[model samples]
Target chain A: MKYSPALQGLIEALRCLPGVGPKSAQRMALHLLERDREGAVELSQRLQVAVDRIGHCVQCRNLTELEVCEICADTRRDAATICVVETPADVLAVEQSGSYRGRYFVLMGHLSPIDGIGPEDLGLDRFERRVAEEGVAEVILATNPTVEGEATAYYLSDALRSRGVKVSRIAHGVPLGGELEYVDGSTLAHAFSGRRPLE
Target chain B: MKYSPALQGLIEALRCLPGVGPKSAQRMALHLLERDREGAVELSQRLQVAVDRIGHCVQCRNLTELEVCEICADTRRDAATICVVETPADVLAVEQSGSYRGRYFVLMGHLSPIDGIGPEDLGLDRFERRVAEEGVAEVILATNPTVEGEATAYYLSDALRSRGVKVSRIAHGVPLGGELEYVDGSTLAHAFSGRRPLE
Candidate 1:
């Protein structure tokens, strides 16, 4: 079917979202096409504004509007501690739980040699430099529990270890309130190996 | 937690999409915040462009830039045969099957008395006048099989029958290749009641 150039263009742009396949993209496009033209236009406008105005904080690579993100600039947060994560989404997840009060260092992505993404790709060099220059006492690896995430954690850990920064990897395997019978074998094994002494 | 005005403005706008709850909206907002400025600005530009450029076709209510939709203007299509539908998405479903050569009349929505959306609200007035004047030979009721959809079809049928125009509803019950055991009881009942004479 011959769709208007504007509709086609809009759908193509919307396809960038995660899990929005062609059919869903088309539906969204048509929905936008139908009711709320003004709202749709506003949404499209905001997409550009957001992508333009938002940038990585120079200190931690977290999303920010200024030279330093709020977390890095805030005096209430512990400047000596840094929770390193793989993406901005992870930062939100951590923030949602409201447990941590320290600053963060976003890796942007994890190491995957097959995809040609390695240590250098994730701003580890900058992190190492930060550790050397800043009086950072501890670095927490909050990367995902996936294999690639674990691998990236180890790489960062070893790199920061020589610089005299205390490094710790976040625990993996077995979620809270999960049934023992439903737990996978691989996760069970990892939990056994990573067991820590209850102080 | 407090957020920058620019960041929050963009995020607030993005929360309008379907299924995008507050937390997901935050992540999306933060994601866009961190990306290059060029993308967000470009998205804003596109939004206005799309809204201004796309409007409803006069004939079918489908999204279009021109006075009449492409489907309405197609010479090969049976203009005398009209397929009545509820929404733009439903129009696409019929189009994808590629079986019908008839043009369409999109109601934009179905008649729902409980929601205060009546015949006039669904553009049935325009449909009635168009069928009468357009030399329309047949009106195919291709609306969904839901209660509202059925009510809409019956309403349109009764309203148009007095004009002596041939109005037929699409067959209900039993999808092609659907297993009998898995079919719902209501659908099976519909199939049995509406069973045609076996050749």
Candidate 2:
């Protein structure tokens, strides 16, 4: 069916979002036009504002409207300890865990040579400069457990250790509530190999 | 983690889309900001333009930028045989099937008294007026196969029949290429009860 030009445009544009396909885009467009015109307007305005204003924090490379993010600006947080993560979402996950009291450095993405991503693309030079300037004592490598994440963590640790900075990787094993039988083989193996003796 | 004001606003606004929750909204917001700013801007512009320009077609209440939709304006299509559907998406589905040569009447939604929607909301009076004015020969009920949709179909048929207009319902049975063994009990029962004699 030939939708009116504007309607068709909206449907096609909605497809740009992750996971939204043709059918979903159609449904969303119709829903916004029919049931929630006000919501659509709000969304449009917000998208415009966000796209125009939001930029990476200079200190942590996390998304922010300001030069520095809230976490980076907060003086009470530990300046000597930095938790490195791949994306802003990872920062949220670590914050939600509520155990960490350190600052964060968001890489935005991991090392991906095939995709042409490198340390420079991830702002490793900026990170190294920050570490030196801040007199950071320890760095926590909390990049994901994926191969790319591990590679990035290893590179970061190698670079930082050469400059006399202590580095630690987050544990990779079965989740706290996960059953052993359901745990993947590699993770189970990691758990067994990394097990610590009782004091 | 506390996202910047603009980023937070975008994430919240993204949740207005159907089926998008907090996590999905966050993901979409970050993705658009990080990887697809141009797409986000295009989506925003399209959304604004659609909301500003698109309105229901006066003839059939289908969404369109013009007073009459393309299907309604076409002279070759059978205006005397109006295929009624629950939404514009259903119109697309029927159009894609390539069997129906008739124009469409989009009800936009089914009659649901609980949701405060009635014949007036479905524009049944407008449909009736159109049928009378155009000398419509047949009205095909192609609403969804749900409770509200069935109730709506029955109501439309009854209303149109009283006015001496022919009305027919699309078949409800085992779908083509679907196995009988895997078919649900209710559908199988519908197939049995709706059985037609072979020529």
Alpha-carbon TM-score of each model against the true structure: 0.90, 0.97
lDDT of 1 at A1: 68
Q: Which parts of model 2 have CA positions greater than 4 angstroms off? A: none
Runs of candidate 1 with Cα error greater than 4 angstroms are: A196-199, B2-8, B23-46
Give fnat of each prediction, in order.
0.51, 0.85
Candidate 1, residues A40-143, lDDT tens digits: the string is 86787667655656677888887667889877888999889999998777877788789999999998888999999877778888789988898899999998
User: Cα RMSD (Å) per model?
Assistant: 2.6, 1.2
Candidate 1, RMSD to the unseen true structure:
2.6
Docking class of 2: high
Q: Model 1 chain A, poorest ten-residue lDDT window? A: A12-21
Error of 1 at A153 (Å): 1.5
TM-score for candidate 1, residues paired by index? 0.90
DockQ of 1: 0.51
Enumerate the candidates' DockQ scores in order: 0.51, 0.85
Colliding pairs, model 2: none
Candidate 2 local lDDT, residue A88:
94
Q: Candidate 1, B140: how far from true, in Å?
A: 1.3
